[model samples]
Target: MAPPLDTRSPSGPAVSTLGRSVRQAGIEDIPAVARITQEGPLRTDLDPESAARSTRLLLTHIAFERGALWVEDGVDGRIARAVAVVPGGQHSPWETVGRVVAPDLARVPPGPDADQAFRTELAAVAPRWVLSEISQGSRARPGPPTLLEAALSWARAEPGWRHGPIAVVADTDAERKAAESLGFAERWTGGPPSPWWLGVDTDPVAPGQA
Candidate 1:
């Protein structure tokens, strides 16, 4: 059976204007979410079916806690982008439990052990914040307003949920601007001018809040 739905009030910090909605993703939403992440303008190549299956499995494991897939809809209610927020636990990285998304291999640091390297690099960049990297994918569509609104909405729903500070690896000035508008600061430049770490401090206002 699928996990129960979360109907509690929004947690964490709150923001305005962006229409945020929560839904328990059924088997049907998998393909759509996948398409948005892979084929959408963001050009994320992750397979929709695989992602959907992964989400379902993850949900099964964390069935007791508050969890949901967040969707940002366009004017017509079509899903512009979506992200899965899971509880922090053994399977879910302690640093990424309440995150809108997690870092993928694309954001892995360059070294023999990429995962360790990535974490080490992330620590150096923002020692105070736990980092979660966002990359371009089919489901990463929507403008900056949509992304920020969605993120803040999720945060507000789980005020006490802990997660790594969000980060984005943008390749262009336009991407940097968009990330900055969402409260990410430039932390460090990466190799070949591709991966630039945008520091996403969880506590943009109060220090030590994140």
Candidate 2:
């Protein structure tokens, strides 16, 4: 069996300039994480009990792997958002979950120093792929695109890993187009249509004949 995950606070310089600190979340954060998700674009219909249970399960799993569950807080110290990074195994799929920025926090472009901090911080976790479900509407909200760019930049920096074919599963043409502009490509055309998977490969030149 694999070793237990590390749920300790991430050690390094902070990565966000919006006066928000990203840190490992504990059991106490379960409710806040669930509450944030309830307000997301992909809101779940699950009841409060179910949602809390699911959140706890995800947080526990991430804690076991030395991976991280990050909570971004506002200046007043209210939890504004959360992100969980799940380590990928050789045969496992990539999965990440989190909330969009909470309403009260300021959104700032990650500076060069901040980007470096992010790269170093993420490398410590070294996930095979990073995935998040960004709401289409969030693109216009303020700082998400910059964060996405920083993520893509990190993926590009690692040559050994195929960063993508990143896919954005969306339900509309406009959302699909927005993903395209950010470098994702269409990999297929069928779905229930409520959530279409729009994807692009990180190494467009990766070997193989498709």
Candidate 3:
């Protein structure tokens, strides 16, 4: 069975577009939160149990005060999208972004490893934030970009996160394109450890330029 959900309140006014609204997630939002993350189709070759476990393990420790999660609710009251943007201090989570996303992390059962990976990277990155997970739930494939923009804009507004750079690890072409288009520069890519595409957005910039 999967872990249970929590109860949280909205952090601020909705960043709404049409009937869609994006807002910071809190502890109470856990059910919808899990639905958003747990239901995403896994690109890796992993069983459903493992995928569910992986999601549960990561979500066990949420930093609500940090604006760690964002949810976009549709007009019909269904959650349309979600993103996990955690706090990163001196180290970049993108360094191990590849291995981290693997569905296998749940096999550890105890789930400490996955938790440690997040905490460890959270402490080591230079930026104040890490764009960890982005999920568009049982909705359309192409989601409204403003939802993401709102989440990002919220993160950028944080005082500490602005002091350094904001980092993300884009695992797919779609993710990579989105990050790049939004001004995240590709820092590097490597697979000897794990296939990872690391990026950093110190400040927003035009797509074509550095």
Candidate 4:
């Protein structure tokens, strides 16, 4: 198993970002992960069936791919936040789920733009790193920086960290803004009918820069 995520740099510059307690999740954690994600910040137009299907696909992939699923503990002794980390080269849960249906247009309220972004930006990425299934529980927000640090920790440990890019799929406006503040570039933007897929990319050298 991979080591727990910590604030360590890829190269010489030491990452002093205080670490958090992260434990590798087992089969038992699947239900909690699923429940939290079901209540996550997904599109409002999304029906319960679609939501359940999406969650199922995402969690299944996380377990099957041996990807990293970090569940942070809340002050109330419940799940705070949960995120699924997958290598850039591998198939992101969003990618798989998207194959079944589009994001923005699927439900109408939030059409298929999110799915489009995943197909274009994430699917076309060159073996880098991906952050998906980012959800927070009823507990206090962990702040975007901490979530971002968890992402970087995975990259810092990647063998190709030096030359690789990082991508994140944000499901809502808030998530998108946090990524933008972190220097992540938007992947797509156009006129009507295209839907707004908030795909973000960060530079390999700076990691935080677009």
TM-score of each: 0.50, 0.48, 0.62, 0.60
Tens-place lDDT per residue, model 2, 42-110, is: 334445566546655655564324234455566888666544333333222322322122111112223
Please report how far candidate 2 places residue 186 from its true position, in Å.
4.1
Per-residue lDDT of 54-147 in model 1, one digit per residue for the tens?
A: 6444433442234445454455666555545443333334234222343233233244444344455555443322322233433344355445
Name the regions of candidate 3 deviating beyond 4 angstroms. 1-9, 40-57, 90-125, 136-143, 190-196, 202-210
Could you tell me the TM-score of candidate 2?
0.48
Candidate 4 lDDT by residue in tens digits, 138-187: 23332545555555465556565555566665554565566676667877
Best prediction by TM-score? 3
lDDT for predicted candidate 3 compared with the true structure: 0.54
Please report how far candidate 2 places residue 25 from its true position, in Å.
5.9
lDDT of 1: 0.42
Which residue runs of candidate 1 sit more than 4 Å off their true CA positions?
A: 1-3, 6-31, 38-52, 55-68, 83-115, 123-144, 161-175, 192-198, 206-210
> Over the stretch 1-210, how does candidate 3's per-residue lDDT look in tens digits?
112333444455777788888887656665566555445444455666665555544554533443466777879977765666665542344333322332222222213454454444444446665664445322334344665566567677665544667777544455556677677777754333233456678465323333
Q: Which candidate number has the best lDDT?
A: 3
lDDT of each: 0.42, 0.42, 0.54, 0.50
Per model, state how many residue pairs clash: 17, 12, 12, 8
